[model samples]
Target: MAAVKLPTQRLYGTSFTCQISERNKDPPVGDEVWGTLVKEFSDVPDASAITRITVRLVIAAVLGGVLGFERESKGRSAGLRTHMLVAVGAALFVLGPLQSGMQIGDLSRVLQGVVQGIGFLGAGAIIIRSAQREVEGLTTAASIWATAAIGVMAGLGMEVTAVLSTAIVLVILAAVPHILPTPSETDSKSIGDD
Candidate 1:
């Protein structure tokens, strides 16, 4: 990687540098767009890397779907697609940097970012109604967080770990209900008060 100084822009007094490669100084348009497409698909010269990435991504999706399918059957709001997207997105977050030659040690930052970002996404699923004293979507939010972790494991080539983790999550989401009622169910139990 060659160091080439480029232009920087400041927003809110913070500088952001954008690099334009020599080949991309003038991006292709119209008929030449195919070249860009080919370049992207061919970015990874190693055939093994392509297969590795593809398998990992597919595994992540399947594991995520397993969790999502259960939630969808239970009529949860963040169902199949949400869980699948979260998993695939998390997998890409890890895959992209590693494919770009980033070391595993450097991945701590990436993992941290994924966890923080997923937390916000999970937060969106939670709703607290002060008037009713009822909180909803806590389980769905937690499921999304767990799904992200599963995706990360898949991305790191720990497919067995990801599969095992999914099994545990499934047991929690499916089997554990017999022993313990969820927050929403607990709230419903108190509906007699209302």
Candidate 2:
């Protein structure tokens, strides 16, 4: 039986979705899991053609680098090198078992493992300034997750979708927040009435 490809299904059905992590025993934040799940598909690209390991690495690195460029431009912690490695490493990981024809417990487990692993990298991108009660880097971490997905898109030969998605992601990350009104502004009148 074939493994479920979460992002492909989710993307087609809904703009957003969520999943629970059995290991963590909690519902993971939807956006983060969605991004990582996309990255995990770096295994075979499509089932039709076998990919060369070297080519996979190049695609992962280059695709990751391009997405990472946008993150680095914003001075994110998980910039070029980190993004590049995550993608290339994921490609290598999925390729290993499949190329060898090893009977693994559904490909989805491999993908789940990828998500569990990337969580460590994502955690590092977040920073808490206890003194000032300020937190940062969540979006940067999300971007890293997204960069990995781009690599999978490249690995799978979905080049146009990958490129278009990357552009859309960049615009949303860079511009959307700036145009939206802050929650504080919307709630100010409520407080004044008290």
lDDT of each: 0.88, 0.68
lDDT of 2 by residue, 152-173 (tens): 5655556677678777877867
Compute the lDDT for candidate 1.
0.88
Top TM-score hit:
1
Task: Name model 1 segments beyond 4 Å from true.
Answer: 1-40, 181-194
Clashes in model 1: which pairs? none
lDDT score at residue 166, model 2, on the 0-100 scale:
75
Q: Per-residue lDDT of 1-194 in model 1, one digit per residue for the tens? A: 44456789899999999776566655558547888688878868888988999999999999999999999999888899999999999999999998889999999999999999999999998877879876678889999999999999999999999999999999988887777655577656342121
Candidate 2 overall lDDT versus native: 0.68
Q: TM-score per candidate, in order?
A: 0.75, 0.59
